[model samples]
Target chain A: MMGKHAQNRILAYSTPLVLIGILLVFVAAITLTGDKALGRMAAETLIRVVLVVGLWIFVGNSGVVSFGHAGYMAIGAYCSAWLTLKPQMKSLFLPDLPSWLAQAEWPVLPAAVASGLLAAFVALVSGATILRLSGIAASIATFAFLAIVNTVYSNWEGVTGATSSLVGLARYVDQWVALGWAAAAIIAANLYANSASGLALRATREDEAAASASGINMYRHRLLSLVVSGFFTGVSGALLGHSIGVLNPDSFYLGITFISLAMLVVGGIGSLSGAVVGVLSLSMMIEALVRFEQGISIGETQLALPSGAQEILIGIVMILVLILRPSGLMAGKELRMPRFAPRSPDYKTSNN
Target chain B: MTSLAQLFFDAASLGGIYAMAALGIALIFGVMNLVNFAHGEYIAFCVFALIVPSTEAVAVMFLGKAPAFLLIPVLLGLGAGAAVASEYVVFRHMRKATPVAMMISSFALGFVIQNALLAVYGGRPKAISLWPDLNTPVGVLGAQVPLLQLIVVLTTLLVVCALALLLKKTRLGLEMRAAAENFTMARLLGVRANVVITGAFALSGALAAAVALIMATQTGVADVRMGGQIMLVAFIATVIGGLGSLPGAVAAGFLIGGASVLLQAFLPLEVRPFRDAFLYTLVIACLLLRPQGLFAASSAKPRI
Candidate 1:
């Protein structure tokens, strides 16, 4: 053990060094990747963060993993995509939504919120049904839910442009803009985690019978957390549509759902830092692996790989994460700085 | 009136498939709550078993029309082989790990198997022959049901009965159930953990392989993607019927089979597009209300 003063000094020096190093690295990565790709990648990563964290809210708490948020995200994306993009194609496709509603095209602000709300609405209804079920039941329900959504979106082309990818909501998303939104989502989840409501959610996850005995209305609490999670997931999805400026049902499949879960597992469930680390590390590592494969030649003839290498890598990573550090890189821990001089009088935690 | 003969015939056939798939999934999940994410891949592997020996070339001498009757033992061997391999590689290390660990590992293993297939088969669907002359439809209310489907249904009944008897009568089966019922008590009572656990994987894997053969016959067209679809449906069936219940799985299989057929038949033009979504909503409603399942276990296992 060090002396109190030495400990304080070490903490102060280490804190700045780590922070500066992280900042420099993040900036360097952004700079090296080119602003355009980074912006898009960051937004995509953030959207993933939202979806994964939303997953953690349910799976992390319940000790049950879900394969169905893809179902929820699809609903959210389609709902928002339909709400925002259909008016122009309305007469041509749907000819169903009331004329006035069909004619209305809201700004990005309300549209994004509407996306979250719409997703949450569905989640609330579905969660009431799913959350009431036990672990595997609830998970399988989501999987069924995804297939159901895919079936609808692919078949119900009238409002959705059918299986032909939805397009033309490009104005709502920008890389940097999405990052900001992602940050806000992270903070919101953090706040919720520390709140009384969050405490109940955590307790339920940790020990259900005790929490239930303590008078926690599990159904209500689960619905609440899911709804909140659904909200962010929806926004991320709308941003997904906006970012791509093109969307289709297949975009959110088992690939995305399980991949996100793997990220959570690798990063550490129940930790915000884990989410960031998972997305950043795996995504970059995956990209790097692909890039690395560029030079290696396979035999008499230069053997270029066909598709699915990325998927294989993901599987390998997931296996690695499970075997080594199974709880994930972070294992439900936060990234924080030392409280050197204690809280200043003026500092306050803001709700927004 | 709806053609009861046709509907029943179709439901029976589809239910046959679902029952097999659900049995495989239920066996694995019951023992471990694993939800073996790699389930579908194994199905693909079974389908590929016949294809590999016949289609992909190493030794041409053993290759021929690959008699249909040979599929049973072949698939059994393939399924058992896949199960043993997966157990050795992934599940063995994960024996005492958390459910999440198994789930992710299963997911990883799934992709690995899938990609390995892709690497070998090149991502296109493969056509495999289980037998000849699938067109004959024997009697049964005058509905022209595929004789293969009939064969499939009878085989299903036989298997389910055999499984039920095995579970209730055999020492290994009893020990397995005892272990599932109460891991600690069974262990304390001298049930060999390794044998019982490996047996569980063996049972499921063999079941999956058998299901894959039937599925390959049913679908006609085979691909790497086939396993995933079967896995998903099997998962849904087991979940709805209640995880870990063999009888429950069969019941759920029949229900889902009937639902899938009906959804295709009675759907209105306006909402025909969202039939799948509607099916999911149906499952969601069942789960939301039942939580445990349509046939959930009567007793808990102390969170083990």
Candidate 2:
């Protein structure tokens, strides 16, 4: 029999394995169905998984609610457009770009990676200043950062095309591409959640004074997590832009911010499994509600709920979940295989 | 000199609205640890209440037909009722949850309210001409000022004075203040947490209604998105003014409004469009300089 420590290590590493299994099953299911619309839906859900998992990398570990990750996503999406769009498209639409950027063109993968790097660079610069703030003040400062990014993007007409959707990009991100990035994000988040810096960040999240006394630099760990988080968030944004083949500053604003946060909180803001499960469960619910709104057929009789009931129902569901299980659906616990001989399963329910 | 005077009037008018909103947010945050993100929806809901719920392009006024005296109170009541009901329905049950959880729930409530309005009103921005006479410009100190601008300034002043009185003299206000200062200590001293929290929500809601009335009258539009911008600025103001500090919140609100106006007036045409960016950059600078806020209450100091 394996020793207790080895058994614990196996259990700890089971999360990513379980997550990979879920992704593979989802991919297989989509392939088996061979429905174009279902493929598109799966692509969107996978992209959301990327974004939410990226969010979990920071918020889950640090226990800080960031209203700013969307800003980084915007930066990444625009950067990707700048790199991957045809030189003619850039010169024609984004006329204010410098000569080099106006004439630049790159492959899709390189552009996406560059976009993530650009977002991480921005995150590093901003996090140095922003991470100084703690608690609600830090959250508000991040929000201010979002507002700044949005205002600049919306009004910089020459550079960004100013509030209008930038189009004509190749729609290169399909289900498989999005799934690849989503899996990468899941693995990265899982690895970081078990890393030394991640542990230190969590310690600060639990008790700042104690963490500091123990020589943990709260600011440094926080900034590190934020940079990592920003990188994946940026990639997700690139995938979204490519999926839609258009980029709009409005799409990366308040609507996505709240929804992404909702998914993270609903799943379990403290664990990798929570982030994945939250996105999966809520995305399915939203899809189901959307289908019902589109008049689902039952025994040849068409039935449809109200057009906007999906949004209302989701809100109600989220609220009910919070009231009933404030820690979230997963309650900050990771996924693991069933024991060979179950002796009344026990798992930690809350991070604290 | 005339342009300067005009700028001042514009700043003060905008600032007044922001101050009211900041006060509303600060009140809730003071009493409860939660920063009520749904306060914006309260303003939206109040404006929508003025018209009959329908999907038509042109909105028929349900409350707009009422006399001003009657209309104001009714709108205020609607805002208060919605706010209090939300607190009871959602927040009351979330007392034991973490602040982050509560904050997300508030966001969910806002989402529900916004989508409900969207369903009933459709996604169109409707124009409602309420009190057209208020739109007329009046000469003030060599500058042409709209009557609505003057009214907004005066109303803000009156509301502030009334709020000060309530906080200082009323028993309910005293309990709220005590609760805001320290909830556990206040409860130990016989303060009823529920009553104080309900009172704060009611006041906050009424203030939202007030801002809604002024906004509807000034802009002559009742779009679902109208309140979002102001709410965001107010939230920023609430933080920059220092948490749990009402006067600080009001002052910060006015300062932001003033800075925004100044930037608009002075920036060259090319840069004028990025006024918000510059304003937010200034906000980041302010936060870096004083993370505790410009007017930090003693309690706001970091505890070892």
Q: Estimate every model's Cα lDDT from 0 to 1.
A: 0.73, 0.91
TM-score (chain B only), all candidates: 0.92, 0.98
lDDT of 1 by residue, A1-352 (tens): 5555665444433422342344346645775778675656655665676677667666666565667677678777766666676566767666666777688677776878888888889888877776776566666776776787678767765666667766666455655566556666666676666557777877888887888999987777777878888788777778777778877888888788878888888888766667767877887777666654564564655644456676687787778777777778887766666655664455565422
What are the clashing pairs of model 2?
none
Tell how far residue A97 is off in model 1, in angstroms.
4.5
Q: Tens digit of lDDT per residue, candidate 2, span A134-175?
A: 888889889989999999999888888879999987898888
In angstroms, how far off is B198's CA in candidate 2?
A: 0.7
DockQ of each: 0.62, 0.82
TM-scores, all models, native as reference: 0.88, 0.97
